[model samples]
Target: MKTSTPVGTQADQLQVTEDGKPLDAVRGTRAGDLDLRRTVLWWKGFEEQVVSRQQELHGIGEDVVLAAQAADTALQESPPRLAGEVFSAVAEGFSTVPGEVPRLLVPWFAELARSIGREVSTRSLADAAGAGVTAVQRAGAPPAGTPSLLDALVPAAEALVGAEAAGVPAVAALHAAYRAAADGTRRTVEDGTVDPGALLVAWFFERGTVV
Candidate 1:
């Protein structure tokens, strides 16, 4: 993975090789001393001396594929984004570039926008649901999933489990009546389970059915 030094011009090539020999990789070998700098005069001399230097050293002496690979390497070595950095970068890219593009890149931008929004939206929903649950608990309302009478209604949910259960008036109205009665009474009955898990399930599900 030894790359030619970073000389971005043609003349630099000949000067680097003016003695008419290839590089001696061993001469500069030193641990933790990679990406070393060459003398300015060396670079200047290379710039003045080379004939096909830029092309010769184009992307570290590699061809087009090598050039692309070098670019990819550079990109890999580049810093990674912080939490907001990527979004900001992509958003800026999206804002600035508003036209047809390389086919490979379109889905990238589209997916970024979609995932970002979806993540944000899902995060918001989770926060809201959490807050809603907390609020209900604080208000001493039964949790949202089932009604307070859920153990009383497990027989109900199972009895009227499927859509066909919807046709059973007794089963259907059973949930309806339970909900109706529960909705009317938030008073924690002295002997009753204040807010059963089943209660939340029943209220949310049955309420949805009725609506």
Candidate 2:
């Protein structure tokens, strides 16, 4: 029997490409040099454009920082089974008894569906939410013929509903929804469909009016 190459080693030797061109060819530079330059530039841009701006906007207040830290810690400590139960309840509720959705949330859901290349409507959203709930309750993979984007939308819907159930403040619930949508965008990108940046921007534009 032949032995297989280690996954990590194979990944390390894999050549990543953009538009079918190797990074070096695309950049017209040595790959290693380009990689280092890109890494440094990304870090600098993140610090200056994200961290600095956030600090300025939030004033680096201890209360805000502590609250954020606490949330992160709680999320990290949550057991997967418990989290799944919470997500399942939210999904089920949306599918069965999503009461009088605020008018604002509909547009956000429509935009999110459109961003993921799906037609949007109350019925379709309810169906997707129902499918998600069924999948969770069965403790198995999603049913055959399930749309791929459900992998993202289910969690995004769960986050929104869960926030509401927890009685999170309105502003915080909106933020949670946006964050969940961002996470969903990331998942689609990893699935090799949807432009991450474009989807993220779509979510951001809808964020203000959601919840």
Candidate 3:
């Protein structure tokens, strides 16, 4: 379905004020708190391993891509299901991890398929999560083991499915998954099993530019 409104324009309109401050202002403050060097390193690795080779990494089906595009179009044209404040938060959260919007469509499509009573395999979800772990390693992060990363990514995929089932906007559902994944990354970092630099790489896949 064609959208009369451009996606960027629609996204811009959704950026409303929260507590008398624009959401972007809030995001900017949050962004300032992050480690710039680590963030840049992570983005570089992700851009090379994941964003630059999304199709090769994820192996997403054409049908899923089409479905995700259609859903995004619908969101662009229709009024948002979430309140402005909530929508802005979701948008900001998703935007934190660049290039995640498209990769996330894989799980989003899975949810839509299941909603229509189509049987979706759990293996498909596992593959998606595993791909992310592989991307992190390829991005120059030390080997943190697949199981630890999967422990975080698997639930993140589930969060996307759950958010979709709750009738949230596609963008918001993607953000939900990102938040879950970010939480996992945070825990992994805290455990000291993974480097802080690795958090940046994981954030990109869990959520980068080429070096």
Candidate 4:
């Protein structure tokens, strides 16, 4: 249940990178580049509010519902048995996804909603990063959710660093990147867009893979 060292603890590095190279959190597949230091800080500051924060993603919150509904509809469209498995996974809090992968559920579902031709709402974009930042940070360490979360986070934080380097305020870059990754308003990672669901399965959840 212990969490790994947050990303920012390195000595005087301007940005965090993978294999000594910069990567994008929203887009990068190999490494998570989101600033772990900020993520940890944000999580600690908001833990009291988000750890117990429970709202049906997109089901009960603002326009996020449209995104949530789209993901649900997409799941329903899958083969009945596979759909059932996905639903079961959801019910089990993404137990099979490994690490702090579950913390990304809200964002992943929101992004999945976007992938299925639904529009990612502004509310969903903001809420996902806001609440999700705290949620991921609150998870446990390696073999639990923390390591995975931290791994996933590397790219996300790196993306924000890029945003800031481009003159975006440090305070606003995270939300902006999260929104861009979700809505396709802009590219946060190198590949073009972010797919939280696929990322979970292909990168985080699946074993012997990128992680």
Candidate 5:
């Protein structure tokens, strides 16, 4: 992956290109990188917003961080069970409540989707789920389908948000999660058994269940 600093953009801003052409595999790679950068910028700006609206952001921030911590802990302590539970929850939940969505989380998830691929939308539960999974994949998840990917991604995400919640630098935390997820995925795949949970989860998500 060759990189170049584009003219007229921020001096440090890189336009990640494939050779001389724009990267487009797995959803317009260059554009996705740019968009992800934009999301990072937005999060940076959100710090200022948080200062201005402490009451609103505090709870949300805590919750996000805590979720990451929980997921991380679960993955480390019980990778198999965690894989099963997460898979079952998403799969079963989607089947019953295909349109289920987190309260007031549309914008946040939308940003996540955009950071991975330029055109994914959060309006549909299936799309939203795909975007979340894809973002995890792009962050360094294995090439496997949903179950294995989630096994890697869930914990890394927990660390990502947990670091931010602890006031760690946002970009650093994100990059860390990416590396961690990729490494974990590689190890899990080497174990040679797809946790049943991961399989079920992948099955449901691919089945087009909502939520």
Candidate 6:
């Protein structure tokens, strides 16, 4: 629960390749590239919002749903089921973004959410991310019913948020990478021609959308 947590992936099976790098929240990801690119400034934007603020991720508004109530028309991040709270909470507060979020959600991310087959108009942010993630695996198909996306990353987000809330700089840096991967995936899918399912892992790598 403290900031001493080592960075890892949402899925227990997947691992982050930190290489032999120093985890510095103040400096941002040890990423060698992407810092020089112009079209994409999110690397730094995310760093400022999330990574640099890692010690505060826990304070990221646990009321993810309560805070998003007015913005979220459907889902609520209530007890026993706050797993997918990101979707609803984000929907409720996304319009006032940056300041509103513990970490920044992807900007103009709705279209990509829809691309991932999520019902953007209805689901919460956690749910939408879930849908986006699921869409890629089903070959661009939407989930049949209640299968949630937040369900996949919830624990990781929570764990990372704990570090942020605790004020751990290094942990925050890892969270920034996660945001970059999330947003970058959305940017790439905007092309309207990429296959959602095919680019699952690419989203985490900041390749934009996919091949």
Give RMSD to native, each candidate. Answer: 31.9, 20.3, 17.0, 16.4, 19.3, 17.4
> Where does candidate 5 have its weakest 10-residue lDDT segment?
202-211
How far in Å is the alpha carbon of 73 misplaced in model 2?
46
Per-residue lDDT of model 2, residues 58-169, tens digit only: 2222322232233234334542232122222222222332222211122333333322112222232333444444544344433322323334445656665676567554
Local accuracy of candidate 3 as per-residue lDDT tens digits, 129-198: 4454455445433333332444445556667557645755433444555566655554443222332232
Off by over 4 Å in 6: 1-146, 170-211
> How do the residues 50-69 of candidate 6 rate in per-residue lDDT, one tens digit apiece?
22223322334332323233
Strongest candidate by TM-score? 3
Query: How far out, in Å, is residue 201 in model 3?
Result: 7.1
The TM-score, computed over Cα atoms with residue i paired to residue i, of candidate 3 is 0.31
Q: Model 2 — TM-score against the truth? A: 0.28
List model 4 lDDT by residue over 1-211, tens digit each: 2323323321112122344353233323322222333322222222211222213111222222233334334444552232123333232333323323353454443332332122222332333343444454444323222223333443443454466456543334444443333322111122322222222222221111111
Q: Residue pairs in steric clash, candidate 2?
A: none
TM-score on alpha carbons, each prediction: 0.19, 0.28, 0.31, 0.27, 0.28, 0.23
Return the top candidate by lDDT. Answer: 3
Could you give the candidate ranking by lDDT, starting with the highest?
A: 3, 5, 2, 4, 6, 1
lDDT tens readout by residue for model 5, 68-142:
334334434543221123322222222332121211222324434334343212222223334565554554444
User: Taking the candidates one at a time, how many backbone clashes does each contain?
Assistant: 15, 0, 2, 24, 3, 26
Taken over the whole model, the C-alpha lDDT of each candidate is 0.29, 0.32, 0.36, 0.31, 0.33, 0.29
Candidate 3 collision pairs: 43-209, 47-208
Worst 10 residues of 4 by lDDT: 202-211
> Which 10-residue span in candidate 3 carries the lowest summed lDDT?
25-34
Superposition TM-score, candidate 5 onto the true structure: 0.28
